[model samples]
Target: MKKQLFISIAAFGILLSTGCTKLNETVLDESSAGGLTDKQAAESMIVPVYATLPNLFTHTNYFALNEISTDEAILPYRGGTDWGDNGIYIAMHTHNYTSTDPNLRNTWNLIFQGISRSLTAITTLPGINDASAKTFLAEARAMRAYYSMLTLDMFGLIFVKEDPTALSEIKRGSEAYDYILNEFLAAEPDLSSDVTHGRMSKQAVWGLLARLYLNAAVYKNLYAGQFTFAGEDMDKVIEYCDKVINSGRYELSPEYFAIFNDNNDTNKEIVFAVDQRADLNGHNRMAYFSLSGDQFPLPEFVGANGTDGPAITPDYYRTWENAYAPEDPKVDPRFYKENLSIYSNANDTCVPAANFYINRGILRGQQYGLIRRNGVFLKCANGNMLVGKLFHDTRNRPTLPVDFTEKVDFSVEGSNYPSGYRVEKYEFSRKSASGRNFGEANIVIVRLADIYLMRAEAKLRKSGDAAGALADVNLVRASRTARTPAPPALSNMDLDLLFRERGFELYWEMLRRSDMIRFGKYEGTWTEKTDANPQKRIFPIPQTAIDAASNLPGYLVQNPGY
Candidate 1:
């Protein structure tokens, strides 16, 4: 049963660097998974597999691949031995990572270990025979394929074995892609066509396959060359989108905030999410990292408790000037929240007070020491959600004193704030620090919004209908802008505009590196600009793994040019 809690247990390791084996150990053994009974062992096993979802690429996953690759976020801690060890490599991609730290073993272990878990379930889950067991098996298979796809996407290789104890048998580059795809194709018939939102079903698998194929050209090229999507591949992408759209099982959620809020898991638009339970199993700092109390609004919202991790480069912020968009200030409410929203739904109206924080700077980025009203600034400030929360147990700030336990409202823009924006993606602890079940929020893995955008990209590129693609892009973007009286729209249809729209819509959602690679932007220079090395797009295989397998001559050739 514990093994089945993969996705759910992420909360415990939100900031975990390594050694999470026992933390996520599968408790459900032979009988717990409805074992050999032929009853529903398969179904029971599936639960544990899905439980690993949110944990897959969250803290370790995002930093290893997503944050390093994307524009809006970056790894902040330096000289640490925890996660994201490829700090120098990260800066090479973005040209900003400056540490000469040891090679990143966190991502290497997390992904590999996580995949190993998926393999364990995939190999063992089929033995069950109950309805839930069957559903779980299908979902686990789909999930296993999903993890395999990412392994291929990021590193170009994967350990193809499912037996947890099996010796490593590396599948290289494109061959790995082929292996993962085969699993997906095999899974198609097994998965449920039902729409279970956060849980995997047939439709979710379809969307993931579509995603892999949509980027087939890149996968086939092994992150080395530019490859075009074959017509058949394009057809495959559209085919999957058709199933999801036609199935009527899922739809886009109407409100922007609701999509990521505490209540979002129930939203109609969610196809798959990393489920988070307040007291149950959860992902810890991901949702909370990007925010701060100074920027968070209202009573409990006044002063953020943690160090805000990263900020938008003024230059990156300006990339919003996609000629196709409307006036900047008039953009959608999502822009406000996504780009900048300071308040949590703490008081509904009164806003949160300053004191009820998890302890500012534990996740602190820039703690403000001064606040004064300026004629130039607005009396009431708003937060930008685009540059979402970034705090993570700051070594700089201390914990709270005894008296200021609840809400203490005051105003001071976080100096670390992006153009004075705050994030509300993760909920502030209901009780600043009660020691357990404090803040629980889902980490969305694949969602309808992402699929819609992916489809938009494929449609625009495949069909060469810029306006039509813009429509799809804007379809998702429009929902994010309701708070603004005059919302932004694609002003001119172009690649640059499309990229900006993607940024506006999907900032810090953990797709930066891949998006940059797909658009040929990963190698380009930006603020804190680093000249991109083509070899750096995909990280070098962790040295530890290489050391563990000394027999293979070419196993550690290094990613082309170390």
Candidate 2:
């Protein structure tokens, strides 16, 4: 029998009682309603908390806020038509978004849903009075802290709710930072050290702590003109990073692309990720979001298509291009992975192949894929597949070739079907043949490379140990030995170079915005964005959230510069 954990409507009422708008109240999974053992009930309670992650991290919501708003990506109005979405993408890219923006509202709601669900588990799990239930409670608290940290990063405030009925006490500045840090520290003892896949574990806690400490200055003074990286905080960051590094539970993946592949759930490098396996509700938007509509990756499902979403900005592309000078960034194992092995020539009439995989990493120039005639895929006389050059799929100019150009303009003509280079870091899901939604690739939130980078940054910032920092950065750079002509290590490292190295290693993973702010480049002009206002560092609280809490006179105040 399928295990079903049915959370009652009253439990949902508790979430809604807080007056937060758009709280997802649906049941987690559909299973035959029946009595469950205490062990089963505890497990069921924690499942919904984990389920909230997929929705929170979806490309349109959290991803848009983090990537599109920074120089790493741009989502312009394609050919003056599609993806306009009431100009939210443009507003986000330009930092002109207001409190009423749907993306902000949606992201805010989704995060709170995670917080609320975790809170529900934290409050109810103790009733079981079992050893497993205690562990589940610890996991719930840790998840709540994670959601709270995200809230602090985005909205400049953290919500603290003891129970469901009363309003949440808001914390900001040091209070917020301390609360999040303490929550994790408190839960660490009870969190299982064993790898639990999607669930919170000890190593995940350590990674999260390292991340929190690495950015301690930013959290401590969010709107300050300049942040002061305290030595003590840096020490803590190093301490936590060392814990994960020496744990022997993880090692860097030689093939960098395999870290984000479809079967990456068991990958040792992934410390924490939003689990999106075959049986769960995983979306392939991360894989197909930036792809051209004309490109079809899956041979089995011709209907599976890309939505032509945001692409890597020229400003970000230059970081890789100019990094090694003369030597093309393509040589770097992390930069690109060639997967279309059967067909090398774009003009090939037919190639014998049972499987087809598209090239990964930063894609440029003309794209090649299986061609279709009328409603059927074209095949050779020998029953092999035909590969051909791709053009725009009628949504844009059909005659225009799908050649990605680096120089993207803000104008309609400049933002054509193929302007900025598209990223294919995450592997396309084979399970979702009909559409680009059900992806099995677990969206990585924390990994070993990031841990190493965090430690390096802390080492440099805390003590100006340039040599020590360089060694750590090169460790990550040299770990990708799977690719031919492995990425060369840097002879020297500085703050600017270290920042660029982070981009080269971790771009499109949704860490760019925070990175830019912490590195003092958030105010720097890039491409079309020129506003250098400090207030733009944190997003305005959603107007809907403010309106929902209107009953409480000063409970939910909006962030400045709305």
Best by TM-score: 2
User: Which residue pairs come into collision in candidate 2?
Assistant: none
lDDT of 2 by residue, 1-562 (tens): 1221245423443332221111122223334123656665666567667767887888999999999999999998887777989999989999998999999999999899899889878878877645678888998999999999999998999999887887789999999999999999999999888844577889999999999988889998988888999999999999999999999999999999999898898898999988777656566478889998888877776777777788888889998888867988888989998877534554555655556778899999888787755656777778887777788854645678989899775786668888889998888888754546777888889999999999999999999999999999999988999877778878998999999999999999999999999999988888789999989999999999999999989888888887
After superposition, candidate 2 runs with Cα above 4 Å error: 1-33, 341-349, 433-435
**Cα lDDT over the full model 1:** 0.52
Kindly list the per-residue Cα lDDT of model 1 for residues 1-562, writing each as its tens digit: 4344433234323323221111122323322422233342343344445555545545434543566445565333321322233445345335433212233455566566556556656665554345555555666667777777766776677776656676667776568778878888887786666544656677777888888887787887855656576777877887887777778877665556566665555777777666665533454555445543223322322343433334444445556534325665324554443322233332222112242222221121233221212211122244311222222223322332111111111112212122223334455444333312234455566677777777777776787767767777767766554455434565557666677666765666677677778878877765445666776667666666667667877655555545
lDDT of each: 0.52, 0.83
Clashing pairs counted in every model: 97, 0
Model 2 TM-score relative to the real fold: 0.94
